[model samples]
Target: MAAGGERAKPAVQSRMENFRKVRTSEEESPLPFSDLPPDVVEMKVKEGSKIRNLMNYAMAQMELKGRRQIVFSGCGRAVTKTITCVEIMKRKLGGLHQVTKVRYKTLLEVWENQDPLPGGPAQNLTVHKNVPSICILLSRDPLDPNETGYQPPEPAAGLQAQPGEAAEDVSGSSSKGLKRPLPPPSEELLTKKLQVQGAGDPRGTGASDHQPDHHQ
Candidate 1:
């Protein structure tokens, strides 16, 4: 009886598989493009033509917008989406379009070179041939006024300071102006201090002494 039931299950599975394949084939059938009305096709073509014309007009306006720097302010997601859309558009239309991907560091560098002052206008910008398809200016949320006018901290004065040594100022400052390095205590002195501390305390010096009695 078991052998018979196993054979019947295979037959049932094969039938179900055939039904699924038929259903999938019907669903995958191409749409009746030829059966569409002549008027409907003409209308769709006209609509597409109108849309293309509108896009061209908008692009022309953008190109003619002059050499003013554009500041886009939004949340991270919106800003990213805007940058992606701009990049795609630039890729479609090639020309003197300049799209620079500016990160926080690169943006600062650009600003430092062009205008060091806060919220100052960038100057003498020339579009090079190697400019990216998208100019992504990563910025904080525009809605949050607190983030505006904030500057990144300056780098440390000394780049090659040792672990125990005081770093000299590279900004033409006197060596005497640098902080004095404190001398490390001798190993023997440290050991003696530890021994004295352990003797005074009832608990032992090691970490195990500080551990709670697990038996309790």
Candidate 2:
């Protein structure tokens, strides 16, 4: 038992050391956008577009906040891709401190319904099944409302109608050669005219009636 316990100690210690090294490396060296895979970059671009749309939708609210907090929810590749995008955006914009504040929530702990257990496994969980991933960005500055509500200036009274151009009686014949086309007859009027024409056709009815007496 003593030998077995001693054998396990070194293995555990080695794992702890490796964990520390990984954590330190992650803190010291963040993954750059250029380091991201092509597929990841493509995904980021797609997700970034959605973030832009959301920012546009709540422009006023984002402006009021004075800082942007991005939340990326997804599993594995999705989370990593968005994180790359966020990091790139931060670096391109001159770091997080340049703005009032910048933050992110990607871990399951942040999105879980119940409080996370202490030292719980930190992993990215998928949300919004169809979407697979989502990203949002807030802005410090207020977006311009760009209100164009000004009423158009009313036309000058002189422009309304010149004294020489008095309203013409359109119903009467005009001096101008242009003639307005007359409206077409309605279905009811056309049907009545056809009936009247049929009644006036005496040969159609008279010839047929006179011939019928021969058969009798």
Candidate 3:
């Protein structure tokens, strides 16, 4: 009886092992490219880019736009840089409204190799990877930031240009004026002048003919 019971236990164990299975489902996340608003100003950030330059550009853009709104976006390793830029801007241009968004992007990889069996077709493998992304929106408008928390920063002059640092002042006057030296007259201008000179004289002796008064 003991031997029979042990054999039956082995059969039950094998059946359980064969029937056991794991089921998993992944949540699909889509990028927010299409959902971005057209009116909002956008700036794309990369990981290896200079933060100081980006901060300057961002500050200038905000000053130029009448809407007083700007957004920064980044993916993968660049996401942290994007946030850092926003923080710098916030501290510099205080009294700004803020909005933030996060999402994941999926990447795919495929590989093909020869099959173990001789003269068989190449086998292919597929893989999927998800990368994170973020977007930060800053504005001075009185409305909500949509899905992102909004905390208005207090007004400050963090980036105010000093006497020697006037280069950062966008709205300030500069010694370098936009007025450039007038270029030499074009051929058309010379032709117009000749025509005027010819028209002014009835004798058809254009301005070039300044007859000399001689004693006859």
Candidate 4:
């Protein structure tokens, strides 16, 4: 029993050490949190605050799963991966993703019916005992359903460039000629578009004009 206990201590310490490694990188530019523009810094603070709050909820709450609420929860290196992956996913998916911060109690409620128990040492330590340090949610609806959001298809080179500007110097442009492209429409938009189409509204011609592009 003494030898086994001694073995376990090293593993636990190893895990904690791995966790610290995830927080810092040997080669990376330092973020200019202090010198950044106020608005940019404000946004960073907001995102950081959100991540911290979500982590707190996970630590106190128990049991996390994917899909039901798109949770990103784990500790140490796992936690770092969760955060990095979620941010990338959000940017790539654009408005298709939604995020929410939930507590561990909420997790247990869904996966284990409020019972916080396990059949083995690993399960016992991982599920109910070890606190989660992060939680991220991605939903199907990042944008409101009632709003009209249409993103025009990307323009071919030279197709939409200014009269004298070279295509290489051209910036991102959509078919709609708008400065900002709207996110893809939600299910509600399709339904509304169908309704208008049936009613013979001229505006319902194509997916592009079916919904108004309202920036949120």
Top candidate on TM-score is: 3
Cα lDDT tens digits for candidate 1, 1-216: 999999999976764343211110011122122222232211111111343453454354445643222222222233444444444444444332222333221111111132223687533322222211122221112222243332222224332344325333443354444534533569668878888888887877654465666445
Q: Give TM per candidate.
A: 0.18, 0.19, 0.45, 0.24
Report how far off residue 200 is in candidate 3 (Å). 99
Candidate 3 positional error at 181, Å: 66
TM-score: which is higher, 2 or 3?
3
lDDT per residue, candidate 4, 60-106, as tens digits?
Answer: 33223222223454433355656665565454433334333322321
Tens-digit lDDT track of model 3 for 96-206 = 877677887554555444323367764555566677878777777654534455555654554453644665464344433433354457966987888987888787645
| Cα error, candidate 4, residue 57 (Å) | 26
- Supply the TM-score for candidate 1: 0.18
**Number of backbone collisions per candidate, in order?**
1, 0, 0, 4
How many Å off is the CA of 43 in candidate 1?
32
Rank ordering of all candidates by TM-score, starting from the highest:
3, 4, 2, 1
True-structure Cα RMSD, model 4:
24.4
Better of 3 and 4 by lDDT: 3
Candidate 3 clashes between residue pairs 3 or more apart in a chain or in different chains? none
* lDDT against true structure, model 4: 0.40
In order, the Cα lDDT scores of the candidates are 0.35, 0.38, 0.66, 0.40
